[model samples]
Target: NRCEYCGDENGPFEIHHVRKLKDVSKGTEKWKQLMIQRKRKTLVLCKTCHTDLHRGTLPDNRFAA
Candidate 1:
């Protein structure tokens, strides 16, 4: 698959979310929403891109610095 960030064609791509459901809701709501939004809401990204996205380094980084 092609990575959503860098367009790298690689094996074992991961699902990258715009906003993690757990970050929005908690407990039961988190699980329910996550399950419902798992597929259509994620982008396919490579390992490096996935790590950067959550590591407070990428341009679209989601983690707190």
Candidate 2:
């Protein structure tokens, strides 16, 4: 599969949650429900893109260019 961010199809890929799981508080049922609902909001990213995303340096047009 190709990376959703950079369209890289020849490297290791990882599922990246749009909303990081760790950022969601686990202290409430509502939060847990929201987390479950938000699970589908993910993107397949290549290792490089994933790293860039974490570093806040991923280009907005990474896949378009």
- TM-score per prediction, in order, is 0.50, 0.59
lDDT of 2 by residue, 1-65 (tens): 88755667797998777465555445243323344555645667789977886786766655531
Candidate 1 lDDT: 0.54
Best by lDDT: 2
Candidate 1 residue lDDT tens string, 1-65: 57655667764688866565455344343222443455445667678767765674555332121
lDDT, candidates in the order shown: 0.54, 0.62
What's model 2's lDDT at 41? 54
Model 1 stretches with alpha carbons more than 4 Å out: 18-40, 60-65
